[model samples]
Target: MPRKFYDGPQRDKPRENCAIFGVACDDIGYSVSKLLYSGLIALQHRGQEATGISLLETGGNIYTYKRKGLVSKVLNNRVLSKLWGNVGIGHNRYATTGAKEYSSSYYLQPFHFKNNEIEFSLAFNGTIPNYAELMKKLEDMGRVFVTNTDTEVIAQLIASLSIGTEDWPEILRLTSKFLDGSYAIIILTSEGDIYAMRDPLGFKPLCIGELKTGKRNLYFVSSESCGIDAVDGKFLRDVKPGEIIHISHQKDIHSEMVLRTNKTAICQFEYIYFARPDSIIDGVSVVEARMRLGMYLAKKDPILKNSEITDNAIVVPVPDSGRSVAVGYAKEAKLPYIEGLMKNRYIWRTFIMPGQNRRKAAVKEKLNPIKSVIEGKDIILLDDSIVRGTTMRQIVQLLKERGGAKRVHLRISCPPIISPCYMGIDFPTKSELIAAKFYNKYGDSYIEEIRKHIGADSLLYQTKEDLSRAITKSENELCRACLTGIYPLKSVEKIREIEDSIAKSRT
Candidate 1:
């Protein structure tokens, strides 16, 4: 097994950065800044460290504004009123690379690139495992970069490809061939056009939509369908895995499927935890997928066969992310569903907190048991997945010690995560994952060991088959790399070798 190369405490669940959004209007009568703000707010759950936007004024230069704060705080009325444009792009970011503190604005997006050759604004989701190799290639060509981010490397690559042609789609097509990681990118060119493209593997989600207000038409590109709904736009469809979509004032929406592959590896975490329930990805509804995961859990649970446990038990979710799954479990098992936990609206998500102690302390501050509903009752607690097991252990203790529950049965919607992810999700190293640790030592007894470690009366996890059936995608069509130690990208495999060698050296 390999240890993490990065030095620091890590969060328990998978966290991804960057939600890209762009809007293009047919008329200048409307400013797109407010619409951009609304779209970002809808996708805010995807990122929380920073927010930014770049707007192209009609017959004027592009203006960029960004800072380290939430979308609501960073893009306030005082700031949005000054940013006037009919075409613009926005981004919400939680860093997986470069600086995590977000102290400098240059590290944020939409990365406004301005050089002697071209000018454009870029917003991006997903990670590039081969970015360092591409950066070295550009450095050899006499390109200088200010930030150590893949976003800068991508901008420089596009500039290099634009030396002979100004066709935005052609430039992006050439740029995509050089990239070897998962990404969904939207670019706003000075020509007042927005170009959106998904990677060949489709590791992230991107969609297009349109809206009509009076006689003007508006087109949007967003990381999720929820953003389009936030602006009252009707979702057209998801961008094809290797497609480049062009939205402009001069033409109907244009699309070019640049690269074709037989298999795609869409991240499975989108269905389990990442995306908003109201959003749909790749023709599958998020809420429906989660509910099906719960149904599967209910079908195979051996403990449910005992009438004594099922008789006095109530199904309870771990707040927002687990609510849909709890609903399905209750419906399938014929148990009463109860909102046994009350969440504090003001606290930040404990899942994203840095240290184990801080996250454990925040768990109590963030959620309190409704003692009246759960007292003297057997509780079936549901959550998305168990990562490091720190939070789950704390929550289980909280339920028994504070809520007076007779027994706590912990149920997880996804299978045990045994591997790290290189495709944007911030899963910890193999050594740090609780399931991975126990599996290495106990083999087939890992689940029982985990149940004992977390202080749960019993534990059950959704099988991989159930996960695939719930999402309605074949095993090859989804990225289960975190559940199984296989990577789809050659660059990520090489990265694994390097990290393994580093771990061996330290040992």
Candidate 2:
């Protein structure tokens, strides 16, 4: 039997994959590490476990520096000064179930792969459901493995295909055919070129930008537009689905549409919770989408139509994650929006602390209610989503016991997540999700059961159709697999089936 490791308390929401940023400058005199640091800092919310950068030096040598820590602590001035290069790529990792054991520097990115035949550094954001199959094929062809990471499999596949030709776009096109899941990858090669590509379905966000200073032009590829903005670069546009973009010191920007599909399944959670509010992904503003979600929730709210509930109701957001939705809800519902909670910024990553009692105390340490504003009022609490129901239950208890609220009505911006996600987000097994468990037991009564479990007077969730309308994207253009239990990739669907059988056997 293999040893299994589990972290602290289950996180409240799904975790994003990783953050990737790449830069190419026209002059070798300009150092790119500081710029990479700034860009990665802007995307720190996506991942915070580890940070690393691989730079291409003047002599076509790839230099890598990575460690387990936040970007600021890992790539300070002293360290950035030593990594001199004109082109480079950086990564911030978010640990997943498959990567929990391999959290060392060896499993971190930018994963530098060098051999007698080729050398390149890769930074990636996403999951490969069929990576095990690909690994088996590679191993049969005489490739040794060091870690059980999809990133390593991806690098080895690209290296194997490079034997035929050095055309980056063509190589990636071949690579895409074998990979089945979400991915936005950037590679810095010894040939002094950077290749960035998005998966055919555009399941993750990737964008390109340009900056000019003192007659020198620099190009960048980042997981989000906010990253480009952080580096004082112009946000050109999003990297198209199945598009391979090549950036070189001597050239402007070259792109090719290697793959095409009638519909693209951009992750809907990016707008709901994952991305920064200021980010523009696939030409849609994240903040605006969230506002629309709240507005839609208010438009259909039956409680708002009741004069008694509306008389003393005050909208209170759960904190930063619920602020935008609460704003829209307040405006649409004609209610007063109050900052009823004060957040202690210093308290974060509370789950990492051992013991259930410690975790419970950490929540109160993280947020305290403003008793004066919320006391003796109908509190309308807004949050992004509910994962395992533990944290939300605690929060509802805090508001009533500590703040003296008469009644609490909870509104969620996203639909219930009833299935595990395989394309980057961290919920892997159906047994761990609150909604999945309730839905399997009570079916259509799951929402009522969840509301009762959390001790809320009423609970309302955003409908799947309304969520799509809020994002201004068609249902076919978004990935709602977590909500619908239908995956976009065949490989992911197969994995879900296998897990379902194992779960059934346990019952």
Candidate 3:
């Protein structure tokens, strides 16, 4: 059987950094390895490039297994059987740092660090914006670096701090002061304890869940609640921003607020695209938030209200991610919701494919028009968002030419992604964004210009206000940096450096 759930390459989607899962149980009766496997499976969508797990046995021994493959491929029955323990942590990695071409395995994580005093393994999700600076500081302190990843830098920092103190939470608090990025990390120590920490800004999501088995209790910490749900655990709540949760071997869970800030900057992309629709993060349902975005878009559409389009006009989802939004839009617009495009379950995500030719070919094989549903109809095509616009352009062409659609109108669920995401998302430079390019070329008429470029009769996006409202938060509380060009972190200099580098590459 193939390891991947979806075969075709992804189209116009931002890649997430990674997913982290950790669990601590009262006894060895439960298979902690198997539970970690289940949790990683639920988070497999967050990353597919690499998977790992670290287990702490009863006798203060820690074993780690990791490789460059999907979770399904890396953790087979034979592999899980060897990882016997009551406490463990797992990771699914999508590289946001380190060169993929140079010894990639060195960067694959559930990174283990050991010294005469302590031993611990870490699984991290999110990027460290000040990675070079911190790594240099550690290097100055005589720390030997093996891998080029920020995960290793963090592990070494913790090890250096553990020398003089046993208070892991205090060490983490001090570590937090030097870090400037988004991160949710799980640490599994040789003492059979697990520690989960989220960044001060709450740029990433982490949640806790509980499983009660008669006389025993099991605790889980994961990047998303869906990981807990996969193991049949009950979700307790999200770990507060800048909180350090320590789950001891005795099944005691304690939390410390190491860093306190007046505001949080949770990545809006989680609700827009990164997370599973079934998962809830920070007290909001991702699916419900997207549905609200569609409703808002439908309510504000002047064309829909004026009934200017043909009577046969229909709402068609781009498939998968766009399905919920299309349903919501159809409900509000009083139009029929139809699956006009059929996706091939066997094709791999196009974005992960190596070459442009291969990616294009995969896209062609991945989706085919449902002629009966789309022929002779005007399509209100709903998609999550457009990144480079290559996929959307091809999709628009396919719908109009092959599906025989009279006209196509594009509705995007979020505002124009005019800037790059600096947290953990893959859009590192504005030059790679179609919206940014269009805005540069067309000035005030970028929307209309992008519509023409995509061969759509009309193009509309959810306003910034609607997007914030749909997520049940004010714009000030969310990370609208990608859309508004306002970064929440003190990394404006780094953003400019990246933009400058990208411009140089293009020239």
Candidate 4:
């Protein structure tokens, strides 16, 4: 047997769709392509499968190019050289329920749509759960479809309703009535106006910024604050959930009443795993949240509750996400914090690489044994969360073999993920879940079962209290359904009925 607990969570797990970045610089002039490029680079972590940029000249014409690949590989100096304009939007993508066709030239955003000569470029992030129903309804109204993306559906829906009232507010007003599910979107008009909106539920994140160039006070909107920082922009505030933000040189940028939804369902994973540590969403610091998780994990000291002398063990972070938590734990535990593994910056990622072989191979390419750093130490490896144990296994072996560590204890920064996340994460089915698998195989709620399965000396996971405290939001504010299996939205009665049919095929 291959003994495969040491696995990278397959990109095979389902995921949220694409990241969006848009910039409108009306003052100290710069090329649209350059601005979009910087914003996309900042957001590369949000997607790796494909990258694209769309440019809108001050005069109102637009040009765009996008394809499946990393941002740098797809758009180099030569490529950016050809892209010219004053305002633009860009996207880095990861396929979720749909395929990569979403990034195809036609599907690429900012999706340009026109009716009776009025034109606008729209770029959208997040998914529309009601797209299939909406698509059929739109198709009945003599609207033809091109690419399969909610963005196009939205564009057409706006066009159909905007036929009579072409002004921005009325167009957006009607849009609010037809949309369902999570969305953070940006729209650029031929007349040089830009609009950004987030869904009422706020299942995704969007932020605004001010840039200091060309005496031009450019406004920025993106899936994360990291993107804003990439272009040397000042982080303003998060685009509130349900708010519609409008930007332009001629008028003060502000959110309009055309789109506003009561209540919210912010994606819980943004704090647990997704958003970059440096970024802040909805007024919360992502890095601060993770560090709190570390401090919380240290208090449990579950295994040490029975034994003394735990002081000798080292606290090692799994690298990247785990680093902050490990630091927090080390301080709380009064233990030595060590960097036991070095990440191979060259490897983009393991899961996003495509095939099983390639995903597993990426583990090797992405990590290096810091033998001198961890050797002869009782190592404790901390990670944000353990989706699948692939890289975890190799990491343990490296510490034991190369670093000469006697014991490799593991610490998880987040609670075990046992259910599929429907909000934004691409968790796929329950079966692809290693924690779910272990829960079935060993019938133990204690995390020790996971340690045994992965051949680890021991494992410590952050408790629900720890995780909640780290996020620092009201329990009602986040979608903790994946962690707690309590779907905030109604049960997927429709999806379950269809999926149940598929499950029968396996049986």
Ranking by lDDT: 1, 2, 3, 4
The TM-scores of all predictions, comma-separated, are 0.96, 0.97, 0.94, 0.89
The CA lDDT of each predicted structure is: 0.89, 0.89, 0.84, 0.73
Q: Write the per-residue lDDT of candidate 1 for residues 260-346, one digit (tens) a residue.
A: 889999999999999999999999999999999999999998879999999889999999879999999999999999989899989
Q: How many backbone clashes does candidate 4 have?
A: 12
Quote the lDDT for 411 in model 1: 94
Q: Model 4 scores what on Cα lDDT?
A: 0.73
Give every collision pair in model 2.
none
- Clash pairs of candidate 3? 7-347, 7-348, 8-347, 8-348, 8-349, 9-348, 9-349, 9-350, 10-349, 10-350
User: Which whole-number lDDT from 0 to 100 does residue 93 have in model 1?
Assistant: 86
Error of 4 at 356 (Å): 7.2
TM-score of 3: 0.94
- Where does model 3 exceed 4 Å of error? 1-11, 96-104, 308-310, 353-358, 495-507
Per-residue CA lDDT of candidate 2, range 26-136, in tens?
A: 998888989999999999999898899999998989999999899999999899888999999999987654435576676889999987788999999988888889999
